[model samples]
Target: MLEELEDLFESSTIRPTFSYVHIILALYIFEKHPEGIGRYRLKENLLIGSGTARSLINKLSEIVDFIEVSGNNKRRGHVLTDKGLRFLKMLKKKIPLLEEGNTKALEEIIIQDKKLNAYICLVKNSADKLNSGIEQRDAAIKVNGSGATCLIFDGNDLKYPKSPNIQNNQVKIGYDLQKYFKLKATEHNTELDKDDVIIVGLGDTSERARLATLNSALTLIE
Candidate 1:
């Protein structure tokens, strides 16, 4: 399969950057249509430039075992090998660990730096007592298409949105992240279970939501 993929890449023209986003997106495209999807279709669905699509396909050839088969009208398309399926499953578990490590590293910088610490202080009071674990406490941040954000701790049907901006400033549907963070702490000294995962939403406004999410995340750190 790898040799076959190399031959295909050698025959193709477009090339893209090394992006996990593209790889994941391609996997998603392949998953949605089990029969297989064409290169043109991937480019169209992903809306990345031609070079990016080529690069993405090239990278996938290296990491995932995929193959070309007859798509609609006998056009060439791709599908996941069994190896690819297992790789994605392994990635699902490891991605969160990677994110946590990075988030913690950033948290350290925020706490140790004077300016960052002061910035966090500004909104800490606003996000008090706002956290409630979803059915499961182990979820990483999930956002949905309607702009809803949640850390689902229960059996609750949390629609994890495909992509969430999550920029401490953007507001999805109507989630009030700033106020949600303030809800975590009733009094300054109180401590909740370190395992607790709080969920926030995008509210009616952006500035307020951003402030709240940023503050709420800080409160969690504190």
Candidate 2:
């Protein structure tokens, strides 16, 4: 655990004295970036000299699950294997590690300290409200002065009732929308907070496109 923690803190652009820390961080990042980060990117980000990086990577390939993937322009790069995945899981502990001076850390603080409940609802027609300078709307079925209602995808209303922990965790959904909406590049533009219920991808009325909207709602509500 300490080795993983130490690797997390090493500057991505600086070469630490220890080469093993570089390998540890690189593997974790490869797991996160499955498409394979480019060789130049790895060199620039991991700060390993070309010759040493090649030799060390070859050595690593002998003992662990490592592969190279080529992308457009045909530059091949490193990614981890199923064996590496199992190894990472063995190394990883259940405890969450919060990074300082970042939004995720701030979010962790909100969940751990402030006891706030955040819910996101995929909404249409909210733009009109925003354009008219009505930024906040309550959960109701209509665009009334007091409240509004909308359909949620996963067999639930887009209503976050007033209760501690939102009916004790029944109201919360944990679908990883980032992975689900991967092909929709524009869907990822929103700024995320730890407790933020981000409702985005508004104004598209196509049936399938709207299904994606429903997916966002369902993912959160399920």
Candidate 3:
């Protein structure tokens, strides 16, 4: 299903700077702002160029009919259609949660000169897909992320899939994540299950961090 979403962004003549995560975020933005948002505001939220934002909306409107324009050029805005709502529902089933995180909790693991914005996402039932966590990190990096960390919840605690020796710090990281992320019993009304994967994406800006996090999470989605 995600691949189908990716297909919507694929082009033969030119490559798109934005990704499917951007599309998902755009839908989320519209859902949050029912009054609708203009292309410039959406572009600021997405941290992309005006042309790219226009292209993203054009493709979504013409190809999938998932969105419709509300106002004219001076204050043109967009709102999702019924089909887009259904599509977002489907995505939620796989990726139940996505949120910003406090990087202070991650300082021990991700040491850097500059402070970074982090976005965390919970991908359901995908722990078995992880090995050394390199795959998830690489996915985030490909999308211009500073880096990413992958952890798995084993019904009791969240731990790095490959690093078990640092149990003490791992426990602290997990606790801080749960505390700061303020995870719900079920974000989409789906309970947190054992073997659920958690991905933290780091970037210089919130938009980049979010896209990076979602990109990392998608690698674990089946």
For each candidate, the alpha-carbon lDDT, in order, equals 0.37, 0.36, 0.77
Superposed by TM-score, candidate 2 places the C-alpha of residue 219 at a distance from the truth, in angstroms, of 39
Candidate 3 residue spans exceeding 4 A from truth? 10-12, 71-76, 163-190
lDDT of 2 by residue, 1-222 (tens): 334333332444654343443554456557767777665666554555776566545544553435454343235566776766765555432101101112232242223322222222333222222221112322111111121112222232222323343445324333433323221223434322222232321212222222222233222221
**Backbone clashes under 3 angstroms, per model:** 30, 3, 0
Ranking according to TM-score, highest score first: 3, 1, 2
TM-score per candidate, chains pooled: 0.37, 0.35, 0.83
Model 3 over residues 1-222: C-alpha lDDT tens digits?
766676676788897778877887888777777667888998998777899999998888888888887653336588877898888878877787777776777665566644789887888889888876888889888878888888777787777777545445444254665544435435446566788877889888988888888888877765
Error of 1 at 145 (Å): 10
> Which is the winner by lDDT between candidate 1 and candidate 3?
3
Clash count in backbone of candidate 3: 0
lDDT per residue for candidate 1 within 152-179, as digits (tens), equals 2122222222234443532222234323
**Highest-scoring model, lDDT:** 3
lDDT of 1: 0.37
